[model samples]
Target: MSTTTGLWLFRRLWKPAEGTPVKAVVVFLHGYGEYIDRYDAAASVFARSGIVFWGFDFEGHGRSDGERGFVTEAGFDAFTDDAEQALRLAARQFPGLPIFVMGHSLGGLVAVRLGARLAKAAEAVDAEAGAPLFGRIKGFLLSAPAIEVDPAVAQPHLVFIARVLGSCMPRIRLGGIPAGDLSNNATVNDHYSRDSMNNTRPFAARFASGVLAATEAVPGIAADFTWPLLGMQDEGDKTTVPGACERFVHTCGSPDAAFKLLRGRKHELFMADGYEDLITGTIMPWIEERCETAEPEAGGAAAAEAGLARDGMSGDRDDEAEPTDVDAVKTTTSEEPVLGAAV
Candidate 1:
């Protein structure tokens, strides 16, 4: 699918199993320097579970048209606007299905803001409008969201210098993330290095500045978040700050929010070893439970309860450790052996 939101953005949808009825729509937001294809494995899981999965390349990444890694127009707003366009497309393609927005890394930051905006919009009365533009959003799923940049990439003086340079040369490429830091699986790392659509090139100065600003602003809006949220982060992740994810989940106003800190996983949790079953054990069940309900207004208690049960909290485990916030839980697991084939 393509949308003409100022610039054309490329998107694709993964339908549910042939004989299955579509129960809900999930809009996936890929991480920075990555594209929609990275989530194909997870999409299949969602599809088989009777949910429609769709995602798009952010303006300058993947198959989308734009200068690589650069937010050429509207600054950071361009990304959020692109997300809205994706939501509109989802609504048009499968009207009335409860929509869930899922984001990873930088996309996670976008999802947080998008979810908050939609939740707020659902409450206002529009005299001339038939329905709110974002009334269908039911929840959010975030994986290692870039609410705060890793310290290695967020040096104050350097970021300040980059911001200054961006003002004059917004399109100048700065530097890109190391592929090794993305995952523990060698095959996944090699695949990312070889994928042409993956933006391995250095980020444009303006794009870096925009991302920094957006990430910094996410925590401030946590008070406004009021939808069911499931956030997962790998403690071993070097690509984004895990502490920030923990803080966001704890502080966010959503009564149904739950955070899981995977012990030996990396930035891309869905692509990590044992991730397939992890989704079956956690994410899939969460979505299915909510989709089965006609109205999600009362979903908070049920979602939280279901999440706790799936994490095996019902029974004691020696590897489990609790975070500072009672709401956030930490579970430690031995690293899963790397697969011989690429994810």
Candidate 2:
């Protein structure tokens, strides 16, 4: 998509299988330094299960335009702009389908902000614009959300310095994500390492700062969240702290919010070993529960117009799907492995 700023964003979409009725529209947001392609298997599973999955590479990640691993100096808004653009795109492509936003790691944090944005839009601002979009968002799915960073890595002094440096040198490289540490599965790690489109370089200063800001602010804003949310994180997830997610779910005012700890798993919940169990055991059922909701009022009339104006985003609709369950889901596990198949 080419945004109003004339930036190109790479996007990917998976439609429901032929002869399958569309049940829902899901917009997935990936974590830092990763792209949409990483979730191909999972997206395919959603499609097979009657979901219309849509996602895009953030401006700096994957095949999208921008500096590698860098959200420019725009900080967090850059990421949210892309996500909101994606929501508008999905709404238009699959009009009237209940919208569900899912995010992993930093993407999880973005989803939180996006969810609050939706609620605020529908209730506080233009109901014509926000309600048409917000009210349609029935639920949210989070995986190892980066709403908080592990205190071990984000020490007070380190965080303070990063925030300071970020203000002055937003593009300076701070750290690099070691792909091998992402998953227990070697193939998954190998694939990630092989993907040149990914941001293998050191993290950008401002991007790091933006993430830290979200960690502190998002949890505090949990009081404003008003949607069904199911969050999962592994105890071994060194990538994101479990306690942070736990605190957010508890602090969140939503009556339907719940947090689950996928014990014995690694950081990459979807790509880790035994991901199938995680899907069938937890993630899918949550998806099934809230996937149904009152349809969007505009039937995506506004979203369709938004889609036509897309400078960012990528691509779903349906009801009474034959139950998009994991047991019956046929996925490309041979290529990599499992939650890579579901969440």
Candidate 3:
């Protein structure tokens, strides 16, 4: 456990098997209303592969200290600040190793923003003293980022009202996310519904509004992404919009980015049945390929261009139009309680 930014964050570090030299470190950011322990299975996969894995509960969720589903001030900024702290912790704990940041759902938004921020910070430092500040970060992996929430849950009228109320009574709690919308896997859904540490409380008005604003800011940030990125989203997901992922992949500035649209998966991809092997077979190889190489491929730009051409998006950099009102969705919170759920 570590305390920072006015909260006590519970952290778990998974090391490689005995005698294995850690080749890289992965800092994981879990989804909203969820905790670190839920990712133990995923973390173990990295551990077995000679990688170090670390994850923490967000300040207001899981074992972390804060008002449930609420950010005291700037919502996205606060979350990113905590994420940066986690990255710094990883750097300090495993110096001289490449670090990869992975985020799922709400955590995905944080990871994407953090990658851009780190790239920008490195650029600034290089310009001044020809040195990089966060040169260790190799890439980012985003799973079903909460760029746009389910439209059914975030009605336009409700969003408008929430924004107004956020400016006034920012602390007022509103309804939370619907559990049924999380995944189609019965076991995973059952576990999520029963987890006590899983926060199903209504979100504070300010927090909800802040998330909406952050989601809207993704396109603007995509133009600054400089690291390798891999984004995966479930086509059948009802928790987040798949089109948002498509837009981000097309507009992202990285020449070494790829997007995978899973046909029948759900919001919580890691929790879905038979996903453990899927992650190991697909996601692990992607991360390993990058980790084994010090620099991005020289043909990354050409490859990205080829991808754009194949998608009929050549020279279409300006296609990042904001989604319509019906598509403007933001995640919500609920107040259901279950025993043995808190991490």
Q: lDDT per residue, candidate 1, 181-292, as tens digits? A: 6765667787788877788999899998898888778877898887878888887788888677878877888766667667666787777766766666668777776667
| Weakest lDDT window of 10 consecutive positions for candidate 1 | 299-308
Give lDDT per model, in order: 0.71, 0.70, 0.70
Q: Lowest summed-lDDT stretch of 10 residues in model 3?
A: 299-308
Over the stretch 126-236, how does candidate 2's per-residue lDDT look in tens digits? 666665667578788888888877677889999988898899888888887667767666667777777665678898888888888977788667878878777777766
Regions more than 4 Å wrong, model 3: 1-4, 127-133, 150-156, 293-343
- Model 3 residue 235 CA deviation in Å: 0.7
TM-score order, best first, reads 1, 2, 3
Please report, as a residue range, the 10-residue window in candidate 2 with the lowest summed lDDT. Answer: 314-323
- Model 2 scores a TM of 0.81
Structural similarity to truth (TM-score) of each candidate: 0.82, 0.81, 0.81
User: Whole-model lDDT for model 1 versus the true structure?
Assistant: 0.71
Cα-based RMSD of candidate 3 = 14.4
